[model samples]
Target: MAELQFREAIKQAIDEEMESDENVFIMGEEVAEYNGAYKVTEGLLDKYGFRRVIDTPISELGFAGIGVGAAMNGLRPIVEFMTFNFAVLAADQIINHASKARYMLGGQVSTPIVFRGANASAGQLGATHSVAYDSMYAMFPGLKVIYTSEPEDAKGLLKSAIRDDDPVLFMESEQMYGLKGEVTEEEDFTIPIGKGKIKREGDDVTVVATGKMYHIAQNAAKELAKDGVECEIIDPRTIKPLDIEMIIESIKKTNRCVVVDESHPFGGLASEVGFLIQREAFDYLDAPVQRVTLPDVNAPFSKPLFDLWLPDAKNVVEAVNTVTYRK
Candidate 1:
């Protein structure tokens, strides 16, 4: 095991996969010469040379289309969008083309590609750049979506995503790139998609979170524990093929739940997870499910406003207290 930064772990996964597979290559804006906008692809260009570590112009749609075409022709391409906010410009390629190509071609082609970058709020980036699109992209049938919090999950899940036959949307938090955690150094370390892990166990309530929100949930859980409120933390690492079963089981054990998410309150992971819990474990629930999410509005640029807009430990603690009837 090795303690690695979140960005370093991601780079390790991509680096290892590319070294092992001749068909794997990386291409995106500033990826080669600039070492990636967030430096996640640092040193990759030197390691793999210009042929494998290619850079592109600031054209999300064009590069995305090229990645899709590469994938269809039996190449694995990792497409970094700098931030998912820019991915909106390439939604036609991501949602329509890359997502549906395999099915549209009757399984004749496999889009073994990964579209990844920072997601959600990254400290007052403003409305245009802080939108969370996990739920929106997860709605697609053929695309697999993953939002990892810890370095271990980041490394393992990314490896699996690169090798999977389906296209993957790997979301990271720009705020969490510096987070350090123990990650497996094994060559073939891989975590399966659609499997949720219980970060902490408790009997009072289940707090579900993903990406950076997981850390918020954990901090809230610690405070809750101090108050005799044991809260279980579950990280739904993969959002698209949601580990509904894991969350449901936790709810059945705890009989209460509080979902924490960075997305807006409506039609996001919180809404979907709350719905699934009710549907699958309604009889077991002792109280209504609560959610801690951003208000139904765009992210603000002001520092104070942005701080209030993003969900944090306080919001999660309040939601947990609500569901557990502690307040």
Candidate 2:
């Protein structure tokens, strides 16, 4: 019955994973002596020393490539990006090399590494920092994309990502890191990748959300329920090898769906989920699958402009109402 912040759970997962596997080591800026930008790696340096908990210069590209190289050479490295936006500097190593190395090498090497930490809009962080790139990264061949919306899911999936034998992109929302939830003290209780979890049950409509948008969809659901509309909410925890089958099944029962995501509308997770539902369960859908996402604009620094670009409860409620033909 103990409670932990979502960020704390993430720290716990990485800490335990390192203890369980001697091959595991962590590297990033402020990770060793400073504990980490968000304190997720706090006390690691004191426990493991500089050999394992390394502090690098502000070079995401260099460190990420080093992690990739380590994974190839038989060590398991967890590369933490201060924020995924900074990871843009490491795109080549991440998308071209780390993602395709195993397949390009004809399945000879395994990249058992985790590239993770905060992603998406948070406060006045502005255009360059606020954009979420899960869609861009998830498009790769040999990569696993993880998007957890809760504390428990964050801990379990992050642990699985670290232990898996392929390169994993574990995205965390900066806003959700401080939110508290229940997490088990067990060492390795992991949630399977490429699966969807149903958070709420309903017969009228399905609202599929990922990352921070999952909480928005849940808030909208509570409001809609007061007006006699029941909503089934599904969270596709991992984007690549996505749980499309679960979405197809949910749409079949609800007959209508509104996918909510924190990213822009085009080429986003919602777009992919919508296309999947159209292909597999088109006959079952009573209405078209609508998406609730940020407007296709660069996230602005101004408070009002940023709010306009972010998806919220009002938009989610409207999207569901439109899809369910409720006017």
Pick by TM-score: which candidate is best? 1
Return the lDDT, model 1, position 34.
91
Tens-place lDDT per residue, model 2, 1-327, is 469998899999998998999999999999889889888999999999899999999988899999999999999999999999999999999988888988889889998999998888878987899988898898878889998999999999988898899999999999988999998877568999988899999999989998999999999999999999999999999988799888888888999999998888899988998898899999999999999888878888989877877889999999888987777
Question: Clashes in each model (backbone N, CA, C under 3 Å)?
Answer: 0, 0
* Each model's lDDT: 0.92, 0.90
- RMSD of each predicted structure: 0.8, 0.9
| Candidate 1 Cα lDDT to native | 0.92
lDDT of 1 by residue, 214-284 (tens): 99999888888889999889999999899999998888799998888889988999999988888889999
The CA lDDT at 30 in model 1 is 94
Candidate 2 TM-score, true structure as reference: 0.98
